[model samples]
Target: MWSRELEGVCDEEYELDCPACGGGLFVAFGSYGTFAAAGDYVGRGAVGEEGRAELAPADPDRLEGVGARLHRAAVGAGRTQVARALTYVFGEGRCPSCDVVFSVREQVEQR
Candidate 1:
């Protein structure tokens, strides 16, 4: 496998093509959360008291494992394929052309 990383945070969303329907797939990133910050309920969320928390749909089986972590890592790195921005969770997206939900990581074709 090749190494992928972005030098800095990205301000735009990245794009990829869906394998199922050749639709546009937007990339997203993960957030940082530490249990030390707030006991057991520590999580990544909006900083402001008024802004709504951003979220993404995730694989039900990988919700707490590598699959989930990979999504978060990609987001945290500020890049999905090269170097860009993302925040949406897995179940967070739908293909405009096919109207398919991003429930599985394999839906999008990696390039």
Candidate 2:
């Protein structure tokens, strides 16, 4: 097995081509805070507010975990294989419908 890491405290969203049915799949990455600050909650408030009110962006160098999810649609445009900047989670899967090949690239947690 290989290692994977989150880029930073950011939300990344994109559509990927489904290898099985040639359909469209939506992939999203949720905000990832630093390892030391993972359980802290961010609340809406003034920038200078103390405690949870003070929101500091996540640092990739100190990250440990990231949130992500994927969804499939019945009717959507198909996409071809291409190289592009994408946020990849640490996992692998295949197209169930078409029995096609799909892969997740090797990644390292930034921290």
Candidate 3:
């Protein structure tokens, strides 16, 4: 395993402008975060004459929470992920201005 320093807002608390509505987007970063995890569960079996049939997700997955991703990335990639993570990595909120629901994410830098 490798470790490195992280450079980004950790446990940050403030508001940012909404790219679409120019609304104030309150952002608060913190630890004890939640992350997206993939897992399998025992699906309920179908009963009756159809015989026993089960349904399960082929591969359940989704993006981890911003804080979790940031934390993990920081712990893993250090500054690289840290830099990108700090760029408003992820979250969904309603713009106080335009009253529109919006998701926050940073775009990949092009070389």
Candidate 4:
């Protein structure tokens, strides 16, 4: 089991590889919004909309297994933001480079 603390605010950016094209992907869930981008996506003239793909957050009621457990823990601890972020983390992400829709969690695990 992963630590519940991981559901906290400290983790906002994730570097993952696109499962289809093997391109570097920046997965961020913060002020910039929940999305994945191919190549550098932070600060000073970041890649435009063409390089990014929006994240589809999971349905809270349909959460199961680890995703459900993590959500419950976050909600129990009153970490609403964390719980919300988890929905994105456990949801689907499309690769802007290859157009492959993949699981955000599974990609993270692969790293």
lDDT of 1 by residue, 1-111 (tens): 112322212422334555557654444443441000101122465233222123254444445544455556765777464222222323355444454544423432244
Candidate 4 local lDDT, 9-111, one digit each (tens): 3568678899989999988887788899997787898988898999999999999998899889989999998889889888899999889999998887777
Q: For model 3, what is the C-alpha lDDT against the true structure? A: 0.35
TM-score of each: 0.37, 0.26, 0.35, 0.90
The lDDT per prediction is 0.37, 0.27, 0.35, 0.85
Give me the candidate number with maximum TM-score. Answer: 4
**For candidate 2, what is the total of clashing residue pairs?**
5
Candidate 1 lDDT (Cα, 0 to 1): 0.37
User: Candidate 3: TM-score?
Assistant: 0.35
Give the range of the ten consecutive residues with the poorest summed lDDT in model 4.
1-10
Clashes of each: 10, 5, 2, 0
In model 3, the clashing pairs are 11-29, 36-64
Ranking 3 against 4 by TM-score, winner: 4
Error of 3 at 36 (Å): 21
By lDDT, the best candidate is 4
Q: Write the per-residue lDDT of candidate 2 for residues 74-107, one digit (tens) a residue.
A: 0122311110112233333333334444433321
